[model samples]
Target: MTARPPLWRDLRVIRAAAQVAALVAVGLLLYVLWFNLTNNLRRLGITTGFDFLDLPSGVNVADNPISPGAPLRRTLLVGIKNTFALVVVGIPLLTVIGVLVGVARLSTNWLVAKAAAIYVETLRNIPPLLVIFFVFFAVILQLPPPRTPLVFGGLVVSNLRITVPWVETGPGADLYGWALVGGLLVAGGVAWWRTRVYERTGRPHHRVLWAISILGVVAVAGWFLLDGPIRPSLPVVDGQRVSGGFSGLGAYYAMLSALVLYTASHVAEIVRGSILAVPKGQTEAALALALSPFQRLRHVILPQAMRIAIPPIISQYLNYTKNTSLGIAVGYAEITLIVFQAIGNGRPAPQSILLLMGAYLVFSLTISALVNYLNRRLRYVTN
Candidate 1:
């Protein structure tokens, strides 16, 4: 180190000095912003602390269990649950639709390819809000009203709500549920055991087959032993009232359908591009190896394409999660809707807005982390 340069002249020391200065500047800026915000809010006669969260939230979310007098904190959590319901259901449905459409886009049949292209182009160009509006007003609202609802067996449809047959737990339900959990644990243990046996003895291990067989045996035996712990709850409508089974609100379906279709359009394009990005030589090699087309696509194309596709798809997921706020239009009470409702009900606007931002940040970060973990697992590693 050339006999220790002057502290200020040393590169490491200079970097450290600059970092400290930058950190100090950032800290001061944050302090100033917070001070200004608090002062402004104080002047406006708003409580700046979070004690308001413990106060009664005199608001009720439609189709949700949150009562008007519930604590604000509990109300917000219930809103989060409603939002997460959409995420869980919509994401899987959209993914399946996207993958099918993407694969169809690459089909050799003219009709199939053209149809997929038209779907992708038409939906992708239109704004997502328009899609949501169309689904809500034109599709969902256009359904026959509650009194003259359409029905097919256990399925009941109307502009007000859609009801479907769902499982109702009976006396042995809790025990049956625990039994299933135990089966899952046994399956997992068996799989690990099989893996270790394969590693030690270098033998073929049909671990998945064994695990599924074990689980299936447990499920069937438990069902009979527990004397049918679950039964179907079929819904029926009487005039404007609907009861029995699980009733889904028209607004929920409208928002879920619109968001899934819109996001799937973008996902379709991502998937198509990723699949096309796979080397043509890989396909040719697959053909040379005498693999069937389905096998070739399944085993060779998808794995590679998925690795390329996931990074961009991560952003799409984050976008979709944020876009769930649009459910407000259809009156599906998600977190954003609830937060706004709180603000309208004399809640502090600034703090409520901050909480809304934090809610979205948590959702987005969680999705990003999960997808990034998958991407990492799928990536190729080398020495």
Candidate 2:
């Protein structure tokens, strides 16, 4: 009797068959999606090419310089830029706050831990939209209307704007930009030197000190060398609306703060769970070595817990990014809001929605890819 084919050979055949089946299924699904899109587009007498992108978009965005006469493609690009601004700003702020709250939940003090738990439980259970609304009403709306601005030092804060004295652009702005770039490079080099010192001497590398000092030195030198070309654009207490200085609108800050807080609560829970999941022996060993609690946590517990925490943290980031779309209710003008407004104004809903989805998909996937790369680097490989 002929011996049965080797299991490895059979397995290959089985895998090949499964792959073919999957491909067919995927092809069928894509065909259905394409057919539906084309059929509906045709039924509605809509042209299906991306040519609509070239036509002038007849809508205006708040705070953006984009005029209604701008091409639809340009409007979409502005929407994308707005979405990116939120993601870039929100992710770092939320991550820092989340990690702090997560660690706080594990605090030895009963009150601290309980308070953290309450915060997480309360915020995580509520809808993000409500949180946005609450933030708008409670914090932003309470700000003095633009007429009577609250002045602190030189900064002016009010409902219509939050203006801080900023480096005013003038001639030699190009020189200032170059100086800033040089300062950053110097700071990076100093940080690298500090790392080398730490590696050789096992001393606490004050990379932060080195970087800050280099940056400060360069900045001061640049200021004088340029004859004070960069003057402060102080906000004046003009009637109602303040002029000059960079100001973040009340709605923008409200949306950003609410989403950050709402998402941080979920991140806190993930961190707490990950910390608990760490092997108890690891903590005990650190204690046996007489490591201080904070040092033990920073060096041992957190490093390990982070490996577990990162994946979930990426999810929270993605959620926060997507939730920025809900900023429409608060007039944030993120991609989703802009797209919805466009659709409401009689643009092709399906294509606009598709573009919106694509924007989010890119954001989510890019974040996931970065996290996954870091996760791989941090993960312990076992045979």
Candidate 3:
């Protein structure tokens, strides 16, 4: 066999050719996109620059407290905050509920398994927007109007809003902060102590109980020392309005609940599949060792299952974050809505849309990065 060309020479030529071809393709694609964008903007009399971002976004953002006179950038920021709020709150709630439902679907009880199965099937089939509408109309709007709100102690649940107690910040704020710091230290100490006890005796460690007791002791002591610095901001009925306390507007609750329910269905499926993917031998081994189902799930099955579950669950989370834009349909004033409003009110459509896309892209990539880190940490490592 003739070695016509040395390996290095041949590889170098191939690499050079591939790089040139890839660069040509990328250049052409960018050229086309730029051309189309500028051509369209000029045709529509819209500026293609970032200057529009400085213009006042002259529209009242419903449910947002920001002034309409604020710059377009501020409006966009408020919208981003609203979107982030939904995702941050919804993700944890959905994940917990989904995990419970997924586990229930595997329960020995016929009723529980079937009920969980029904919920997953029903929810996953429905369109998310319809679910949002249903939640808003049937649950939120159907409640008694703001005048005669449902009251349970300091809490008031109304058609227009739900109000709950919020501690009014007082002069003893520093005391409360120190109490929180003390609680953290105490909780950490309790956890460390529990670990030591578990190591020494190989007994069940009630780490949660230990941590809670420590934190509770610190908090209760701080409460008395602070001399009732925090008090209830109760909701009061004022004619046609419910005032006082922190209110969750009907649209906010509706949008959050809808996304949570929708995302939970997908998360439930992922949990079920991940759990099932865990080796049957692991479950059997736990049983052979006389482990209770809860202990087996907690210690043996879940750790393994979580490795499988996290990647897909991360995707669901990203999807939920992106889906928060759907809140615009119900007037929830999320990022997408604000972008559209800005464009309508003389902000350049191209630049505003680009910014909106960039925001979502950043949110998605950040979530992916976090998930990748967790995946690396959890992945099986063998020497």
Candidate 4:
């Protein structure tokens, strides 16, 4: 090879130098901006630290009263918890709805496909904020007031709040939780073994049935071992104070319902697209095997479609997470609401906003990481 050119003329050297220069410039710009912000705040006699977390937040959220001398930290945690609750409940509900509707859109039956199309078109076209508002003011707020709350099948429903029986964990809760995880792992192992056995001996696997039975047995055994560490908590409303079960404010329901339906529409479209992306030959091959439609879709199509669906689905999860911030509109105390409230109550805006951003960052990264892990596992590999 010829002698290398000088750093000024060499392509690799120029590329490296440009990247380093850009990074240094960006860093210097950020530092200058930070210094300017600090200088302006100091001149205006404003503080910028998280010391505000300890300051007393005088506001009472929902029916949950904070003592006047109580630190803002507790309130912040509650807000974060509310945000977490929305995501935990909403994702599963939306996913089931999305998959059902998506698959429905591809049905051979005219009515089913048309109906799914209508649903996807209607919701996805409407602004999510509009959906939330309609759900809040027109739907949830239209329910009977708390004083005349409906009681049916252990559920309490009202314009003020919706209360449902949720599990209350006891002293053995942590250990019992681990036991549940163990049960799942054991169930998965059994399913895998069943698949292996079927492959070896050409027997009917029925792995789903086996997994469910194994999991249920383990769960029941764990429950007995822990002396029922998780108990049903039914709402015991004694005037203004409600105890026992989980209670969500009407705003919470509105937020959750609106987001779930709105997001499901988009997810349905994604699923529909992913299914279409699968090779037509694959479906034809399944048909050639004399497989019924359900068998063809279930055993052949979905597995491949899901692999395509997962990568884009991760984006929907992230979108749903960030969209929870919109909860602030309807008086739901998600992190965004509480942070803004803290700012309104004389907390440092910059620091509180930073914390708010960080919360969303963590939530998005966590969801992305989990979905990415699943994506990696499901990724197709060929020898």
Top model number, TM-score: 1
Model 3 misplacement above 4 A: 1-12, 193-210, 380-383
Question: What would the per-residue lDDT of candidate 3 be over residues 164-221, giving only the tens digit for each residue?
Answer: 8776666787888788898989799889889999999999889988898888887878
Query: Which pairs of residues have clashing backbones in candidate 2?
Result: none
What's the count of clashing pairs in each model shown? 0, 0, 0, 0
TM-score of each: 0.93, 0.89, 0.90, 0.89
lDDT of 4 by residue, 1-383 (tens): 89999889999999999999999999999999999999999999999778878878887777566565678988888788989999999999999999999999998899999999999999999988999999999999999888878888778888989899998989898998888898899889989999999999999999999989988997899899889999998887777556778888999999999999999999999999999999999999999999999999899999999899998888998888899999999999888998899898889898888888998999999999998998888888877
Q: lDDT by residue for model 1 over 75-158, one digit each (tens)? A: 999889889988989888888888889999999999999999999999899988899999999999999998899989888999
* Per-residue accuracy of model 2 over 1-383 as CA lDDT, tens digit each: 98879766797788998999999999999999999999999998987777777888898887789999998888888888887888899999998888889999999899998999898989999999999999999989999988788999889999777888876877887898899898999899889988999999999999998899888888888888887768888888878767788888888888889999999999998988999999999999999999999999999999999899998899998999889998899887778887887778778887888888888899899999998998999888897
Could you tell me how far off, in angstroms, the CA of residue 46 lies in candidate 4 after the best superposition?
A: 0.7
TM-score of 1: 0.93
Question: Candidate 3 or 4, higher TM-score?
Answer: 3
Which residue pairs clash in candidate 1? none
Runs off by more than 4 Å, candidate 2: 1-15, 194-208, 380-383
* Model 1 spans > 4 angstroms off: 1-9, 189-209
Task: Provide the global lDDT of candidate 2 against the true structure.
Answer: 0.88
Better of 1 and 2 by lDDT: 1
What overall lDDT goes with each candidate model? 0.91, 0.88, 0.87, 0.90
